[model samples]
Target chain A: MRAVIMHGPGDVRVEDVDKPTLVEATDAIIRVTSTCVCGSDLWPYRGAQKSRGPARMGHEYVGVVEQVGDAVREVAVGDLVVGSFVASDNTCEICQAGFQSRCKHQVMMGSVGTQAEFARIPLADGTLVKVPGEPTPAQMRSLLAASDVLGTGWFAAVAAEAGPGKTVAVVGDGAVGLLAILAAQRLGADRIIAMSRHADRQALARRFGATDIVEERGAEGVARVKELTDGYGAHSTVEAVGTQESMMQAIRSTRPGGHVGFVGVSHGVELDGRDLFNATVSLLGGPAPVRRFLPELIDLIMADEIDPGAVFDLELPLEEAAEGYRAMDERRATKVLLSV
Target chain B: MRAVIMHGPGDVRVEDVDKPTLVEATDAIIRVTSTCVCGSDLWPYRGAQKSRGPARMGHEYVGVVEQVGDAVREVAVGDLVVGSFVASDNTCEICQAGFQSRCKHQVMMGSVGTQAEFARIPLADGTLVKVPGEPTPAQMRSLLAASDVLGTGWFAAVAAEAGPGKTVAVVGDGAVGLLAILAAQRLGADRIIAMSRHADRQALARRFGATDIVEERGAEGVARVKELTDGYGAHSTVEAVGTQESMMQAIRSTRPGGHVGFVGVSHGVELDGRDLFNATVSLLGGPAPVRRFLPELIDLIMADEIDPGAVFDLELPLEEAAEGYRAMDERRATKVLLSV
Candidate 1:
């Protein structure tokens, strides 16, 4: 089976590897139909994050169950499914509280790497949500997105409390941030501001329901948001980039008592306690509980109500995984869908 | 008129000063009936915070309206009232959103020196809440507490989302933390854990409805909380100490989907974004919009349903203001009420 692996920083490759087998009764082996390169993947690929030697490379996937362990009751052979980046027993207190990513018994699916021909999904019943019907190629891409980005963006919007009467400012222009604008729109936000300097991404942001765009970054970006919000700052802001500047921008761009939902994986970000205290904003973020929104997202995609798959600007065969990584790392593609 | 003045760090004096006069049409002159020394005052007194020369020393007070500017309509001369530590216009969008402390037109009452014979309150119609009737000495003290500590505690509990079926953990043993236990109780939290090592404070915590007490600090305290909550941590945690350790402890002690409401005046605290992200808990904190909770708190205190005044373990006349500061600075009193 061909699988993506990283030999070192900026060195992603697709090579033949042994197909995965179920190691637990609760596991299911899935033949991946679609997968993608995430903005987060750029962390290690760009050497911003340390690599633990050669490692398995992807976490997002829409696939068909090829084999099921005896304990896998929710999903079976031939069933289409989408799973969260993090595997969780949905019954745990944390998961039940809608924070499945932090479930007591959790496994990060990134370690299992879905950019492959076949992958073993642990806690199959709890981690994978079965798709209701056959999906077209476009719907398959959207379902693949439901595995991570779309659900993450939805969580960001919900966390930011972006709803009717809200002016939501998104601080990143990546796929997740663009999708968060869509989520905020669906959640009934009155206005959506996409903070993007990139023209192409800004266009997509507008297409996805952004009512405004501010190309500025940092303090200037916050100032722009405030100017647009009657100098009170936006009612809600989403920080989809984990850098210190983006985090602070999100916090500062929100009005007092407003919400800041940050979904980007943090890297070297240290927030001054005084700043956070003085900002007086409600903050909820981290690895999103994608599983919590997966069912609804799947329904939305299948029903054609949302087209999150539009984020995939490039597509490549599994053997061309390196080019996919390069395209994303160089900002040539917002997201790359890999035909596994 | 006499006022408590911080000449410098560790030097507080009761000095003759000119009585305050209304400078704004929105101002109201209040004859200080009662004021209290706050734990935050100890910060400047102990030199943890820099002193900007001689400074006014208090922000919490219950008083009678001595005079009112033309625009002061909500409060009138001779009416007893309580004003939040931060004076707010309350009509601004921020205040209307229930974040009065961060209102567009806010005045920190600490600058007005509430521990004086008479003080001027800005935004009187929005900042001062008149008492329904004459208050007994007991009720007067509680009303004074509502000016800051009680209201701050209530805000913390509310921000932490304490309510029925929730387990609340309080991270500081100061008046605000102890009062937060009372607020959590009033909010109907099922279990309340007071993290305090001081026996006297612990007794007060129990009286205020603490169901359990954890003496451990830092990681051990978090561990104890998790042990008590079946390894999931508290559903709501109040951080009333603005130290790095207390903030982290509060964050760490809450379950993934739980909330941490902090109200302590932050000094030297820096939060690692990674730690907060991985914790996956909601965070809301700041100076506290005390005015938002004042009206209900007054009703509760006036009805004798709560005894927040019990936190004032010592009392002093205006002449002994120096001793009040000393007692609080020396940790000899939990709180000291001053009669003007």
Candidate 2:
């Protein structure tokens, strides 16, 4: 088996590694069908987040159950499935509250490295949501998205309360932000303002139902968004970039009593508590309990209700994993899908 | 007319001032019956928050409607009323959403100096909620509490989503946090934990509804709260102290997916974005939209359902405003009420 490993900053490599096997009674072996690089993965590759020696990479995975341990009941061998970044028992109080990312006995999928020919998923019954049948190529692509990005975007929209009559604004034109626009539209948002300066990403944003665009950055961007919403700012704002500037933009773009769902992996961002207190907005976000939305996302993809796979502008064979990482790092690709 | 004025930090004086008169058709003049010192007032008094020369002081008051302009309809000249620290026009979209404090056309009650013998309340119809008939001395004290502390506490409980089967933890022992216990109990919380080191405040918290008391502060306090909640922390936590340590404690004491309602005026607190993002807790707060809860609270108090005024441990004549401030500043009193 081959897997992606990071030896240090900007040193992602594809190397032959031992194939994974079931080690826990609740674990299942998954033959990786599809996986992708996440924005958070860039943190270590860009040297923003420290990498402790050689690190296993990739958490999002869409695969087939190659084998299952004795305790696995819901997900079975040969079943097509999607799983989140966090594997959990799903019956804990935290999981029941839709925060499986914080489940008491959670296992991080990143630790197992899913960007390989095979991976072991712990708590299979709870972490993996099985697709009913073999999916079309299009459905497979969307299902791969449901493993992380789509579910994360969906959580942001829901947490922001982007429903009928809401004017939603998105900060960061990354894959997740673009998908958040689609999710907000699907949730019946009255309008969506996408903050982007790129022509290509702007086109994709418009295609995903963005009603307006604000190209300015920082204070100017916040002012433009407020101008688009009658000077009251947006009813909801989704922040997909973890930088301090992006976080402030998201918080400032929302009106009083509005909601902000920030999914950005906060790197150096520090929020002014006084600003939040005076702003009168509700803030909710996290790593996103992707497992909570997988079932619905799978059904939506299977039914051809949404095309979240459009985020994947570039795709590569699993052996050329280095190129995929390079393309995303250089901003040449919105998202890069790896077929194993 | 007489009013409390701060010539400088620690320099409070009751001086003769011109009586207020209706300056707008939406205004009403009130003869103040009772007013009180607030925790936030100390911010400037102690020179923590900068103060301009001879600033008017106090925002919490219960008064009689002494005069009304032609346009004022909801409240009459003979009616006794309890108003929020912030005056608002109820028709605005923000107000309709239950955030009257952030109303498009809002007025700070402090700017009008409620501590004065007479106050001109702008947007009278929306700001003042009339009490039914006359109020006794006991009712007057309770209503005065409702004017600020009690209303703020109720908003905190509501914002924290405290209710049946939930465990609530309050992270301050001021008048507001003490009353939050009462509010959470009324909302049907299964258990309420009061975090206070002072024995007096702890006793009051227990009387109000606290099922447990943890005297520890900072990290130890968070650990104690988690131990009490089966290592999952409280389902709802109210933060009523706006320091960095208290804010961090409140965030750490809540379980994932739990709600935190913070009502303290944030002074110098700055939140680490990465910590909150990974915590998976929902945060909502601001200055309390006290008017939203006034009607319900008035009924509750009139019916003798709760006694929030017990938080006021000291009473003084309006002429002794300096002593009142000194008592609160020295921690010699839990709360000081001024009879105007």
Candidate 3:
């Protein structure tokens, strides 16, 4: 088996590794069909997050189940499937409440590394949702997205309460933010505002149903959003960038009593309580419970209703995994897919 | 007319001032029958908040309408009314959405100085809710409570989504928080937890429908709440003391997907975005839209179904306003009422 591992910062290498095997009664061994370098992967690659010895590199994947443990019921041998970044026992009280990320029995796929030839997924019955059949190449790409980004974006939109009559704003132009625009559109938001300076990302945002784009940042950006919203600000905002300024912009761009659903992984940012208190906006965000939305996202992708995989601007062979990481880390690509 | 003015920190004086008259087309002059010192007043008294020279102090009151502007339709002269701390034109889009405090034509009663013998209330028709008729002394006390603390606390409970089968936790033992327990009970909350260390406050909390009392602060308080809630924390948390620690405690005491409604006036506190992002709790709070709940709260008070005024532990004459402030500042009274 081959897997990508980072021994230290700026050091990603794909090398031979021991193959995965079913380790728990709820575990399933899957042969990777495709995987991708996520934006979050840049946290350690850019030396922002501390890395220990030989840390596994990926958590997004589309695969075929090769073996299943005794307790695995939803997936079987040779079944095509999409699994979330976090493995969760759907039977837990938290998962039952639609918060799979906080499931009583949960496992981060990062530890097992989905960017490999073979990986064992814990809580397989809860984590893996099977595709109708072997997917076409484009379908496969969209299915791979369902493993994390699509589900995450959908969760962000849902958390933001973006629906009919809502004017929604996305703070990040990354894959998740772009997909959030699509999700908001699908959820019937009347207006979608995308904050992006990149020409290419802006085009994609427009394609994903963004009704407007604000090229500005901070207070100016918030003002622009207010201008578009009759000076009331957006009714809902999706914060896909977890920086201090971005969070504040998202909060400020939302009208009083509006909702701000933030799904960005906060990178050591602190929010002033006074600002939040005075804004009178509802703040709801965290590690998105992707597993909770995985099934629906897979159904949408399989039904050809949404094309979220357009976020994959670059593609490569699994053996060239380092280049994929470099491309995403350097902002040369929104996402890079690796064909295994 | 006499009014309580804060000359400086730790300095309050009751002095004769010019009686107010209708100044705006939407304003109404009211002869204040009663005014009360709030927990927030202590902020300036203790020098936590800066005060300008001879600034008027109170924002909560019950009064009789002395005069009404040409445009004042809902309220007229000689009407006995209880108005919110912030006067809001309830016809605005924001007000229609139940966020009257953020209405375009909102005016703070604090600036108008309800502590005076006569106060001018702006947006009178939208802010003042008249009682069915003149009432008894006990009913007057409850009606006064409806002016601010009761309405604000009820809004907190509503924002936190307290209802049947839910467990609610209230942070802060002030009038608003104590009233929140009663509001939650009325809203059908199965259990109410009041975080209070004072024996008198705790006893009052229990009397007001608090099912449990946790005499702890910060992390320990959250832990105790979790222990009582089967490790999932409360379904809803109302934060009535605005501070970094209290806000965090309220957030921590709520389970993932739970609601936290905060109404405490923030005093230079910063909330860590990372912690909030990871917590997966919904945060909603601000200067409460008391006007939005005025009609219902007035009904509750009029029916003699609830007595939120029990939180007022000290009563003084209008001339002894300084003692009212002193009692609240020294923590000798949860709340102080000044009869004119």
TM-score each candidate.
0.99, 0.98, 0.98
Q: Give the poorly placed runs of model 3, Cα more than 4 Å off.
A: none
Write down the lDDT of every candidate, Cα atoms only. Answer: 0.94, 0.93, 0.90
TM-score of chain A of each: 0.99, 0.99, 0.98
Clash pairs for candidate 3: none
Clashing pairs in 1: none
i-RMS, each model, one decimal: 0.5, 0.7, 0.9
Residue B114 lDDT in candidate 2 = 82
Q: What is the two-chain DockQ of model 1?
A: 0.93
For model 3, residues A1-340, the per-residue Cα lDDT tens digits are: 8899988778999999999887899999999999999888888888888887788779999899999999888889999988888899988767888988877787989888989998899999998988886567888999998888888898899988999999999999999999999999999999999999999999999999999999999999999999998889998999998888899999999999899999988987888778887899988998889888887887888788999999999999899999998988889999999989
List, for all models, the DockQ compared with the true complex. 0.93, 0.89, 0.80
* Highest-scoring model, lDDT: 1
In angstroms, give how far residue A114 of model 2 lies from its true place.
0.8
> With candidate 3 superimposed using the best TM-score fit, by how many Å does residue B184's alpha carbon deviate from the native?
1.2
Off by over 4 Å in 2: none
Q: State which candidate, 2 or 3, has the greater TM-score.
A: 2
